[model samples]
Target: MSDGKTIILNRIREALRENPAPRPHASHTSSDQEETPRDHTPREWLPKVGERLDEQIDLFARQSEGLKTEFHRCGTMEDARAILSVLVAEGAWKKIATHTTPDTSALLEKNRAEILKTDTGYQIDDLESCDAGITGCECLVAQTGAILVSAPSAGGRALSVLPPHHIIIARTSQMVPDLTAALELAKERYGNKFPSFLSFITGPSRTGDIERILVLGAHGPKRLTVLLLED
Candidate 1:
């Protein structure tokens, strides 16, 4: 491996070591008084989030100008199949979802979609070759309109980044109030056994690196579609 690759691997190792598994919470996870979800107006929190999501979508649309974005509510396995059909029909991806379960697997096959099946050791190229990527999310934060993803089952980290488009299948119950709650939940879930990678994706890949010009898909997928299932 090149020196840069070696250094990156070492840094990943260090990060894993530095972030030991989260210790289980003492009282109902974290403190006895968990921060309850707020029942307030949209203006109660950061207004930028709304704009960010809207802008983020617009930015992603620009990145995926030729591609399509679809959002669906998966109420049953059949619903999942239907979504897969649309994704396939649009040729939205060259490959199907990764790191999926048998049920999801069945759905994929039933839909006659091509998928990549691995034990969580797949490389970025495997994902890059694909048209899109999909995985389950740990949680979603409404305040920031982000998804909390952790675990090797999610295919380390590259699965979400390398693909030009991503589809995360999650239930509405995963939605939390804000980032603080997401972090607290993380601290409780793994304690001292945290994985090597944890991602809080608020929106699609973006940057303002080129002469301060905002660019989407500068590093990761230009489009991200979340299929939220009913609780």
Candidate 2:
């Protein structure tokens, strides 16, 4: 065998001799004693989150920048509407897809583009053809800069994923510190009848498997924009 291969095999054999493998189902203690459970807390490993709202928002913004998410903090619904209008104009969007929520409906009332409501049902082809998808989120996670969406809160599943651009209209009240808090909020909001679909979207879809070169929109929306309005 090659010198490198022989050296590796010799090291493996030495390690095995020094540690001798234990027999199957070997027990050192009495069978009646129960084993201690492993710790399941995630906060032990996750990044620290601040208690104040402003700190959380700042962290979220920084994380969003790293993820390439377009995040806009609007002082009011009017400001959010203005931003949406600008996006529509810039993208030259002819049609947009959305589910009807009070906030979303009001924001898009004066919008010139044709609106396709996906709440009831919609054709996949029609949804795919839309320039953008607008939906309300279940919550925004500050820790990971993720937008949580469920079938009930957002328009089913396809509305947020099929369109080229995904727009999220959220409120400051919907922001949470981390995934644990977000899950708790969801549990509190929907006790027994949880929605069939729930997802945490961190950023626009991307892949870099082909040539180690990043490519966006490979599997989903090319752009993710968040318009967070003050409550």
Tens digit of per-residue lDDT, candidate 1, span 72-187: 55787678778767767887455764777554465566655567755546655665688777777777766556778876536567777777777787666665655677788888
Point out the worst 10-residue segment of candidate 2 by lDDT. 31-40
lDDT of 2: 0.90
TM-score of 2: 0.83
Model 1 misplacement above 4 A: 1-71, 211-213
Candidate number with greatest TM-score: 2
Clashes of 2: 0
Q: State every prediction's TM-score relative to the real structure.
A: 0.64, 0.83
Question: lDDT (0-100) at residue 116 of candidate 2?
Answer: 97
lDDT value for model 1: 0.66
TM-score of 1: 0.64
